[model samples]
Structure formats: C-alpha cells, structure tokens
Target: MKRRDFFKKGTTAALAAGVVPIIASSCATSKAIIDDRKKDKWYHLGTGKKAIPERKITKDFEVAVIGGGAAGICAAVASARNGSKTVLVQDRPVLGGNASSEMRVHLNGVNSIKGKAERETGIIEELLLHNRFENEQESYPVFDHVMYDFVIREPNLTLMMNTQAVEAIMDGNKIKSAKCWQATTETLFTIRASIFIDCSGDGLLGASAGAEYRTGREGKAEFNETYAPDEPDGWQMGATLLMSSKDMGRPMQYSPPSYAIKYTHEDAHPRRSFKWFQDGIWWIEVGSKGDIIADAEVNRHKLMGYLHGVWDYIKNSGNFPEAENLALDWVGSLPSRRESRRFIGDYIVSEKDMTEHKHFNDAVAYGGWSLDEHNPGGIENISEPPSYFHYHFKKIYEFPFRSLYSKNVSNLMFAGRNVSQTHIALSSSRIMATCALMGQAVGTAATICNKKGVLPRDVAKNYILELQEQLIRDDAFIPNRPANDANDLTKSASLIFCSTTTSGDAKNLLNGISRDIDGNINHWQSDGLNAEVQLEWETAVEISTVELKCDTNVKRNIMMRKDSKNDELYGNHVPIEMLKSLSVHGRVNGKWQDLGTIEANRTRLIKFNFKPSKVTAVKLKLKDTYGAKNIKLFEVRCYA
Candidate 1:
C-alpha cells in the first residue's frame, strides 16, 4: 500500500493506526457530550457526522530523519537500507530542499578539483543516475518527483511530506519524540525514535532538543583560521533568489513589476557579471546579522524584489541587443539559504582541518569542493565580490564522525549545513552532494546506535572502525581509509590474474580501494573488450554473492546542471566507461559453471547473487561498456 494511503483505506495498518475517541454513551455525561457533538455537526449541515475529526498521529520508528533535502534523503534511505525502520520528514511538499522546484539550486559535490571531479558515489550518485533516465527532460519539478519515487520505493522507509518537525519532546538530555506539524492535513505527528538526525539545514529539531549551537563567523584566534574574521561577529552568510529566462523567436516586450527594485550596472561588483544569466543568477542574495531563520520571511520578500529588478535591467536596459528577445520564464519566490545554526559536536571542523588535510581516525566521508564563501553582506554589499573562492582542494579531505553528532544533546545528530563546523569550513562542505555523504554516514551510524543501544558519542569513541567498515561496504568513500571486511573472500584468494593488461594490475582489485584518486590508479582496465579476471582459491570456498565496483568516470560530474551542460567537466548521459554487460562463472570439480549474468546494468556498484556453491576458482567475463571500447573495474568482492 502507498504510505500516505493510510488516511483512505489502510487506517488499520499498525504504524498509522487511528486512535480517535468516540462517545461511549454509557453515562449521562457521555450522552450529553454526544448531544453537543451532534449539535456541532448539525451546525455544519450534518455532513461532519457525530464527532470532530482528530488531526494527530503518533508512530514509532528506529530512526527519524528531519529534513527532505539531499542530506536528509540520503540519511533516511541509508538508515532504512541498513536495517532501521526510518521516517523521512520533509517540510515542503517535495523533496530536494534548495534543489527542489521552489528553489532550483544545483546539487553540487566535489565538482572540480584541478580540472577533474572526484565525484561522489553511493546514494547521491545513484539518485543523479536515476534522474538521468527518469528526468531526461531535466525539469526541476519532474526531478522532484523522481526523488520522491526513489525514497518511497524503499520498503523500510516511510515518507511524510509537508510535515515540519517543530518541537522536540525531551527526556533529560535526549530527544524522545519530535512533535511534527503536517501543514497539508492539519495533523500533528509525534514521531518517536531511538535516533534523531536533523538535516533540515536550519536544524529546528536539534535546537528544540537543546543541542548546543552557534551562528555567524568565528574569531581567527579561536581556531587560528586564516579565513575567519578578526573577531567573532553575528555576520552569517546569506541566501539567494534565483530566476531563469528563455529566448523567444521574436522580440518580447518587457515590463518591471511595481515591487521590483531599480538596478543599474554601475553599483554592482565586477565579479557579479552575467556569466550564466540564461539560467539563474547566483549573486542576487541577502544575509542577516542576527537570527537568519527568524529573518527568512523578511529576507525572502527583499530577494524577490531584487530578482525582478535585475531581470528588468536585462530585459529593458537596451545596454545589450542580445537580450531584447529574452523573457523571464521562471522566477523563484523562495530564497535558497546557505548558512544557519551550526550545531556543536565533539569535534568542530575548522578551516585548517580542511586546508591542511587533517587526518581523522573516525573519518567517514570525504569532500574536495573549493572553499567558496560568499561575501558577508551578500548582494547588499555591491562593492565586494559576490564570493571569495578561497582555497581549492588539490585532493579530497576527511570529514570526522565526531563533527556530526551533538556534544550536549545525547541523542541528536546532524548531517547538513547545520553540522558542527566553523563558518570557514562550512564554505566548502555545505555543497549538497558533500552533505549527502555526511547524511549517508550518520544514517548508517544511527543503525549502529540502535543495534548497541548507544549514543552518537559512543559510536565515535568505540565502534568507529565498525562504522567505517560498514560505510565502505555501502560504497561511501572516506579519504585515507581502505576496506578490510574480514568476510570478503576475494582477499583470501590464493591467486588473482587477468587475461589482458592495459593499465592497472588485476592484483590491485584486492587492494581494498574502490576508486582511483590522488594521482593513483586502483583500477584494472582491459586492453580490449571481452576480457576476463580470474580468482583461484587453494581450497573450495562457499559463496553466494560477487560484487564489482566498475568505473563510471568519477573524474567528471553527471548531476543535472541548469543548462544541461555536456562538456569535458560534465556529461549529460550515462558514463560510456561503465560496464554494461557482464557474467560471473565458477569452476566446480574442474568444470566451469554459470553463476549469473547481467545484460543491462545501471549502478557503479554491481552485484550478482546465486545459490551458494563451493568453487575452487571464479572468473568474471567482462563484455561491453555503455560506450567505451575497454571496460575498467576498481574492486571486486565475494561473500557467502
């Protein structure tokens, strides 16, 4: 049954079971109350029946993910897939957060590092690739539904849209339940869970739970951050209002709305030049000095005015004949936010940690995006550059698990912009795809928390290695970390060999690294198609699953761009280098037997499962790629 269909027919489902109070009619007081209820219904033309509808629901789950953005989505999905009963609560009707239809910010990760993208894999990559086939039209609204389908299809996940988790019911220092207000149905949801992850960007749930947090820039002396302000201040980074324009075949007349603010090129910063104005301008923004969340509405109004004023200059200024035929197609009323509510965790990620590439024993995720911090005053400060693209990472840096959970609130954790990070560190790590990685990490950690009945701090302190291993097993890349899962039988193979050699050695597949990075190759590329890689065990081993991490060209991005850019840095379609067709075979009693074959594959991590068989040798027959002539594979694993 559809999850939301409980209101219609599946009301008896245990999770959404209704507990409405009906008149018992056993006493005079009850009869009097029933008479009043009947009188109230009679006032409504008797269509409302005998009782007032109860607009509240109480449910239980193992994990509760607050926010439906990239981070929250990843967190909820990971929690569910990792064996936790998870609930995904989104404030808006659609998912994707800033990248949603309301605010069309692109989902960016380690977009470019020295001209090559150390692109994210795992859930984020899977979502983008799903959009490649499902949202080929590249419409933001359609992409929203694509994300909706992805989350709801997971059997263990429950999605609640248009629900805002506003209040936290606390049990001492831990959050026992979240009082979420669903706007659409006027129903309040009390979601009880053992673990609570706040990825809502603004982090209302954590704040209500008394999670220690701070806002605005930190003083340089605090963390010795070169990019930090001279002294601490309440100057937080701002939000942006985006708009798109389309060109008509003929000249289109233009008029500015009355509320539009007047604009001239003379006052704006030189860096704010219209580079990709055909899509949406990113510099049209505003920031706050105090509480940014409280000022969201006031700032949103000003942003809409500024957006139209800029469009007026483009459409009617007559400064450029090229824009005469162009007309505004989409203007966003909602502003895409950047910074607010930095929760305090055991370890606060500072500028130097990212710049100097500080190693963390509990690193569970990695990021390489440039430290692109926007100007303090945002577009309001016309003299300053829109953003300072501070330091670009030459290589990826580790993100610690200690920076993801609350330092004071025992049960609260965070995964998005609200995570424990100095403002300078957030400048780089706030990218959506990077946040998605953090989400996946914390989500997986939530499952461990449930299994052991521990808090987030305990997981970081003691069970970190187990958490890292599970993350690697789930395909999340952590810098300087390699998988050493003892159950993987390929590492125990007596010999590993390849039929052909063109680039990397087949032995590298057992090295535990899944991707080539830092100018090093961990992959084995066949000189030609129809190649084979064989693993021989000294003794017959029982196995039922073989997994391969094939190349999907992580050096280039595949996320949907506003312009649908298909260039060297980005691809509009599937990666041609991906292994499209492959078959696994096993040798039993010195005779080869078919294990499994996949004709059309879509994900970078491909798996083949069959009945367990004891085989002395196993071979992988690599056939074709999506387009490339030769196929490349980074790692392989066999498990019973």
Candidate 2:
C-alpha cells in the first residue's frame, strides 16, 4: 500500500476506536538515512534554472528592501505608496519567508485574541482584506502565490526573488549599494538605493555592513530586565519542523533506524512536551534547542524518522492497540526558526520596557505575545522531552521606532523578527503581525527619507512625526494619537472626531457606513457621500464640501438642510458631473460644501450644527447613487 493511503486507513481505524496517538521516543539512532529524492536544494522557481554568475549590474532606487518576508513586503508596499521607486530582494523563490505557501506556517498574532484584524496598515492589510473578501472565512493556509502576486504587481515595486544579497557596499557609515547573487544564472547584481531596510531574520545585511549586534543573553544587571538570568547563558530558543498525523486500522510492524532518537529527561534540562489541535489539524512542534539555520536539514530528517517511529510504536506495540490505524500525514518543508542574530539598533528593547510597560517617544508598533524561550539542547539524557512555552508579561508593550534602525549604519533600517531588541524582547515581538507593522513603519520612513533627500537617521530625528501620521492614517495603531491642539471651532473641528471604535458590532463597521447624531458621519457605502460632521457651537455651522471618493465605482448624491427655507447645495448631482470618484487625497468642490476623496472604508465624519437663533430642527440627506445600499450611520450625538 502507498504510504499516504496507509496513513489514511490508519487514521480511520484510530478515529473509530476513539484513540489519539501519543508520540514518545526513548532511543536514539546511530545511522542517518539519506533520501536522495527528498534532498533539500534551493531552486529558483521564477527563472526555472540554477543561479548564474555575472558582472555587477548597478541600478539606483529610492528604497531597497532586503529579505522578502512579511515585514519586507509591507515595507516595500509602504515605500512605493509614498512614491519611492522600491526594489525587493529575496533569497527564496517565494515572497513570504516563513509564512510562504512552500513553508506553510500560518501567520499568528495576538490580534486574533482581541478579535481585531491584523494591526498592520498599507499593503499587508490590503492583501488580508482581499483574501477575506475573496475566500470568505475559509482562508486559512493562505495561498503564498497571492502574496507574491500582490507585491510583484505593484507599479512602483521591483521584485527580485531567488536573489541572495552577498555583500554591502559601504562608504564611511552609509551603505551605498547591496551586492546580490542571482541563483539561476549565478550572476552578480549591484543594487543602489538612497535608503536601505534590513528585513532578514538573521540580520544578514547588518552583519555584512559591519553593524554592531548581539546573540544570546546578557548578565542580570546589564539591561535591568527582571527576567535576565543571573548567570550568562548560551541557551536560545530552538527551531521546529511541524508534522501532522492521521489514523488507519490494522497492525503494522515498523522499526526505527539506529540512532534516530536520543536523550532522556535526565540528559536535558527543562525538557517538556505538549500537543494541541487547531483549524481541524493536529500539530506537533519538535526540536527546540539547535541552531535553526545550521541544522535545518538534520532536524528535518530526524523529525521525519521520529514521526514514522512513533507510528510504528502505535501500530505494532501494545501501548497503543486502539491507535493501530494512526500514521504520519504531512511534514513541514522549512524549519520554523525561533531565534538567531539580533542586530543592534539606535535603541535596544530591553526586558525593562516589556515588564514596566515603558512608553516610547517614537512608538511605532505593539506586541502581546509572552516571552517564550525554548531549551537549547535535545533531550539526550533527560527523563522528559524539551519544549517551547511562554512566560507571561501581564500587559502589552509598545515598540519604539528607534529599535528599527541600525545604530552603526545611517541608511539601513530593519524589521520583522530581526529588529534591534534583546533576546527576551524579540521572543514576544517576533511574530508576523507585529513584524508587519514594523515593516510598514520602516517603508514609510524610507519613503520620506528618499523623497526629502535625507538619511534614515534624519527621519528618526526630524520626520518621525510625519512617519507616525502616515502610519496612523493608513490604520496602523501608533501608541498615541496626537491631540487636536487648536481651540478654533471651525479649524479645530474634525470630520472623524474620535478614532474608529474597536468594540463589538463596531468591529465590522470598517465594512459599513456609520453616522453619529452629533452630525459625525462615516460613509462606508460604495456609492455614497464620504463626509464627516463637525459641530461649531450648538447649532451654527458650515457644511464643508462633501468629499467624493474617486475609486468608488458608482456615484452618490448629497443634499443638506432639507427642511430649511433658505438651504443651498453645490457640486454636480448628475451622473457625469457628479463627483468623479475620490481616492485618499482627491477632493471635489460644492457651492456650499467641499468634498474630499477618501479611501474606501475610511472613517469620515460629516460636520454640521443647529443654529441657536434659527430653528429647532436640522436634517441632512445622503442618497447612494450606485452600488449596494444607502448611507450607513455608526453614531449620532447631540451637543449642548
């Protein structure tokens, strides 16, 4: 019988018996099995050939993003949106590093706990929204090709996959160019950019550029992080090759190759293991204490062998007679890495920041995952197995912008799991969702620096606020929203008075139109007036032009003070002369009102007021000229 068919049958039998296979190993194999068909090789899927070598090809870009992971993709999209000619380079054929379809790891984060969509802005969110709309709610194990298509299709983005950055061209403290190798042709290419971002999880660019960095833990007193150990330890979290299993019936004889399993609870310190099920799949996370990159292949083989051995025990051994049908299903292609190199940035996130919930001056992102540290060695001598687990930090913490830039390199920035942070801090912030936000911030900052003809360091010093504003405007959560300062009623009035509500029912409000009684209106309709209500005094106010969003496929009609005897309205209400659709910054002018172009689903509050001396009633009208239903209202407030 085929291995796959055998496993299927085994799974059916196990299920019928109501038994879950418990995998445990007590012996180690001596000889490594070499599988020629399954040998791991880095291939260039784009060009369909091996890497080629050639002379350096130099090209200048506004921003160069290294590493095509989640963070790198977000950064590239941000830079492009900010009008920077951006290039994205990756060592693999796919765009997503760990979360790629090839790798098959789901994007995980705390946002799911809060029932919030991923907190990233710009392209990442765009991709998620697209997937959500297209796939409905069945979009788990995301298609990696969609991610690749999204980045490659961007007009301002240049994507180079299967290209490995080999060296950094530096002049003084700034990186002038990045030297990359084309895997298919084995040719070299030189990419020059005004600003550079390091999204590589291993700090590859930082190391190549001679940037300062640290690996492993510091002494207890070094950063004053309470979790810092008293003695210096070399231990770090290990990597894992996740596998799944199903059940089959009938007894099967299986024997482990020698030296397949090693160590006992006595040999390993802090050895532990556990299991869980999610998304209708059984997951097994093994291997927590070896060098992730160096021992990737070895661990992969060991895991495969161990899984088969566990199946043999379940079928042939009496310990699991009820699990006679259990068998291995699929194993992960890439090792899920937990820790490696951490670059030194302008600011190092210490355990103190996490424990004390320290506020940052240039806060750009947030993280809520616990400080999860895995043991560093295999369970050779231990009586129990080693595992991965989290240590609670009690509160969520903010990550500062300074931690995203290289301390020693002026043009270099970093994001993803490799940002400037201590081992403990990285453990919590390394998740893909937080890294996506970091990528967006870096991309926006790089765009600003390129447009303004400045360095990344200058962005941190001078344009940090601008960068923060851009991120917040795009829906990323910055630590604090700058307070509205001016006291002028007209000038100070904002269409979107308060931030979008994050509570229930309001959760999907981003998907609909909403209005508050105070005249604050957020139009989520496809073909409706995108406007906000601002109150100037209790009743007296001016109706700012109703902004017509450009990207909207349909047209909308706007009428005001329907009951007023002397009411006036402006702009075209007809099909062609109607607002020619609006985008993020597009606006249309009406005789008595001005309409600004707004991105779809953006929060727009229409401002209006009742005259204390005029009448006792006020009315506003919005008619959807095209698509879906009429205007949607979120809240309505009355002022004294």
Candidate 3:
C-alpha cells in the first residue's frame, strides 16, 4: 500500500474506537501530504498558502518580532520608533491578528466614563487616529491592509509577510537566528537579530527553543484565585470560528456534509443557540471543545456546518422571522484559540496578583477585563450553564513587565495572549486592547535593552524607571501621573484660560484653533466669544514649577498676574522663555524679558520667587509669534 493509504488504513482502528475519521483522506493529495510532513509531524496543515518568495540573508536587525497580530505590530513599531532596526514576521498576508479585517472581531476594552477617553498611546493610538481620519463620519472594521501599510511605511520597520518561523537557532541560552519557511515558493530563509520577540500567541518560539512554559490551569492554591477550581486539571478553553449572515430578501438554505456531526436537544442547551448580526450579517459562533491545535480543521468544518444549520433552522423551522431573508456572508478561516502554550517568564502572573492588585517594581501593563474562563467540552452552546461558559471578576487589575520575558531565554520577549500568566490571568489579558499594551511595553523594553546592551531581564531591573518614563511619554497609562508628583498649588485649581483664532475655521475645539484669518484676540475678549475655554479639575497641591503645552508649533508667552485682593502685572513683563521647539517658560519675577530653550516635545516648566509678600494679583499677557494656535497647559506647581 502507498504511504497515504497506509496512514488512512492505520486510522481505521482508531475510528472503530470512536475517534472521528480524518477528512484529509479525501481532500489531501499525496504530494500535499508529503510536502506538509517535510519538517516534523508537529506542524499544522491548514488552508492558507504563503505568498512571499524567500531571499538570501543580506542584513541584520536589532529586534525581530514574530506574528503580525496587534501585539507584534505594536512591538515592531515601538521598537523602530525607539531607534532600533526592527523586522516583523507574519504568516498571514495582513496584520491585526484576530481583530484583523479578515477575522472581523470588534476590539473591546474597559470603557471610559462618559466624555472621557481611555488613555491608550503609542502605536495603538496612532492606528486609532488613522482610523479616525480615514473614517471621519463613522466607525469601520479597521482595514487589515491599512495596518500592514502603517508598518511598511515606517522608515525603520521591515514587514515580512507570508513567512513562518520554523525554528530558532539558539546559541547557548539566547536566540541567535530564526529559520523561516515561505510557503509560496517552498523556500527557507534565516533571520539574525540581537533580540527576538515571540508574539506568536501559541508560544511557538519559546516552546521550540526550550523555554519553560505551562499549558493548563493550576490549582486554586497555586494562584490563590477564588474562581479557580480546587484541583488542577488538564482541560483548557477551546477555539472558535466566528461566522455571519446578511439579509438577502429570502433565507438561504444550507445542508451539512454527510460526515458532519448532528446536534440534538440532548446535546446540552441547544435552545440557546441563535443568530445575531454585526458589521454586515446575522451571526453565530461555533467551536471545538477539545484540542485547538489538533482539531482546527474539524472545528472549521463543524463551525461552517453549524452556521448553515442555523440558517436552515431559521428558513425551514419558522423560528426566526427577522432572519428569514438572511444569507451567509463570511466565515472565519483562522480559528481564534482561547488557550494554548504560555511561556513561563521570570514572573508568572497569578490570580493572587490580580486579586491583591499587586504593584510590582516593574509593572509594564494593566488589565481590567474580568477573569473569563470557558469550559472544555461536552456542550455545543457556550451559553450553556454547567460546563462551557464565561465568568467575571469585580474590578480591573495590573500585570507586571517581568511576566513578558522568558526566565530561561536570554534575549527573547513574549507578548500578546502568550505572556507569562496562569490560565485564569490569561483570560483577562487575552483581549486585543490589553495585548496591544503588552506589545507596546515589550517593544519599549526591547529598545531600552538594545540601547543599554543588556538582556530584557536586566532592563527590567536596572532601567525600569526609564522604561516607565518612556511608556508615560508615549501615553501608556502608568498608575500615577508624573505631573501629579510635581509640587504645584494651582494644580488643584480649575481656571478657564481662553485663546482666539485669527483666520481659520474652528469646527471642533479638539481639532484646535488657527492663528491666521479665523478671528483675533478681540474675538476671545467677550463672553460667548468665537473662542471658549473649559477647564476640568483633576487634583490640586503646592508646587514650584509650571509647564505649558500647545497643540501647534508657535512662539507664545503666558503673562500671569496673581488673583488676590490687588491684581497687577507685577513687575516687568516676565519674559516666558521659548524653552524648546514647542514650550515657553520664564521665572515668575527675575528676567521678564529674556527667554531660553528647555526641552523638546515636553511640557515647559518655569521657576521664580513668589514670596506671599511681593505680589497680590498678577496679570498675564498672551502673545504669539509663530501664529495663533490652541494650547494646553499642565504641571502647574507652587512650592511650600
């Protein structure tokens, strides 16, 4: 018998013992099987074919990021922005991972209060800003090509699509290079880098390169999580393929293949299964309750069949009238796995860490999403009560940076759903928004490591303060704001400072005001003037330095007069120094005429003597040199 036939016949006994028959026998050709088994039996055979042609090695990079998902893209962008030569490797043609246009899963996170925006920064925020500009009137599924283009356009980033990292070339404890296989031309190539990031989600690099990792849940005592079961188990949350349907005037009929499994009322809460829609169609989710990696194909077929059956029920069973005209729109090609291999880093984030709201010396990321765990199997509907489901916790929590790097591996950093966390902790951090933050943190850390000529672990220990400052500068929210620590009395005061435009159309205040042709300083003098000012108070305290920030490039000075029983412009015009490219400062009383440079892309701070005796009411004169623009002032302080 032929090799393919021998394997097919070999599976007969397993089938006789109740294992599902292999569908590849009919669809897979001998040549395909031989090609797929070229490496090891551990590789997964799937629907996608790689498209990039392999090339010979000609360059080296500071950082290499595997998997073009949200985490990987952010990591690459952050590393590159920090002046590192970065390369991103992705197997798929586009970026965004599970939240990509191909997958179409809506991104979710902790919703900020009304009128308040979540503090998301770095590449993720830039992407959102791009989305905002591209789709001004409405929200759209962020196009995957846009994501790919964003990375490609960056001067320091090189994106390698249709490339799969097959093996890690290790030198002692560090990864020296990676061997990648391009499916399009059946070619292999090698990539050499100083640092490697495993954003592959499945911990593929870590596992292949002998990094320590965990696969299943730990006992409750291990993590001290109340939601965790008392005893440890081998069971893990499964993977799912999301599908949807569109209205087409009449319900489309679909029939399952002969080999497809059928569902019965006794199959555990089949009644809860129903159709809903988003983006373009009414939808339903179907998944594999067993091994995600092992049963990917089986789950794909079953999910398709389940989707069709759902439409069939709507059309023939008269259960859903609103969906009678629904037609199949799209089905996910890649399975979204909830749990798989997790790299064991220096610090494994446990449920106890989350519950206690542990503040780490090297905290890099935060997750507020609940601890949601799904059941292993035996039920088709995820909403079913006992086995397959989701659970939640009361509040949000923080995750440390040490959990992102491997304990055994020297220069490797892990991001996304594969970071070092227990099963319960993974549930909350698995969301794409949180994962993007993890990527940003790792990318920032990678840049610091490269600059300091150190490992990721070393960066975490020695340069953690620098890392935190960089993250804060990039707008990633650390628990406390640095400005809050500055000594400032008026920091607690809420005052409305106004600016008038000269010649530009002011549509949205957030968009900012222009100095030319819109209006003039006179336009801001009257109540209900063309320009308005609003101040929202955060906190107040005494401080010694004050900084001002503006949205546009301009030379401006803020002349301040104290608001006391007597108000006056104090002495000579306290010449606010044009400290940096965007900021201005001056001592409160000394040199009111001469200004100097401070810092670039940072708030400008000014210091001067304000002896509760010398001044009562101080007046400020506002002037512009580079033209009028909307400005923001912060970090105001008064020394005790």
Question: Cα-based RMSD of the predictions, in order?
Answer: 9.4, 14.3, 14.3
Where is the poorest 10-residue window by lDDT in model 1? 4-13
Q: How well does candidate 3 match the true structure in TM-score terms?
A: 0.68
Q: Name the 10 consecutive residues with the lowest summed lDDT in model 2.
A: 6-15
Residue-level error in angstroms, candidate 3, position 543? 22
Each prediction's TM-score against the native?
A: 0.92, 0.67, 0.68
Residue-wise lDDT of candidate 2 within 1-640, one digit each (tens)? 2111111101111111101111111111111111122334547889897653333467888899998888999999888878999999988777777667445555554432232222333455455544433443232244456677778888999998877665677899998888776655444678998888988787666677887777666667888766666755555555555544455465444465563342222332343432222111112233322244444445555554444444454445565455555555554555666677778888899877876778887898877666765434432212333433446644457899999998888888999887888877877788786788899999999988877888877888888778876675454655434312122222322233312222223212232222111223333322335432222234343332222121111112111111111212211222222222232211112123322332233222323332322212222233332343333333232322
Candidate 3, 1-640: lDDT as tens digits: 2111111101111112111112211122122211342333342348355433223443489999998887898899989989899999888777888767556654444321111223334466556445433443322243565676778989999988877665677899999887665555454557888999999887556666778877767878887777666777655665655666666776566565554344433433443444243222212333232344555555555555555554455555655667666666666655566677788888888877876777787877776666666544423443353222234434446678899999998999989888899888877788776788899899989999988999998988898878876775454655432423322344344443444543222222111111111122211221222233332234322222333322221121111111111122111121222222332232233323222233332222233443232211112233332222333222223334
In model 2, the Cα lDDT at residue 488 comes to 22
Backbone clashes in model 1: 0
Query: Candidate 3's C-alpha lDDT?
Result: 0.56
Sort by lDDT, top down from the best: 1, 3, 2
Where model 3 places Cα greater than 4 Å from the true spot, the runs are 1-55, 112-119, 136-142, 250-261, 264-291, 378-383, 386-395, 481-640
**Local distance difference test values of all predictions, in order:** 0.86, 0.55, 0.56
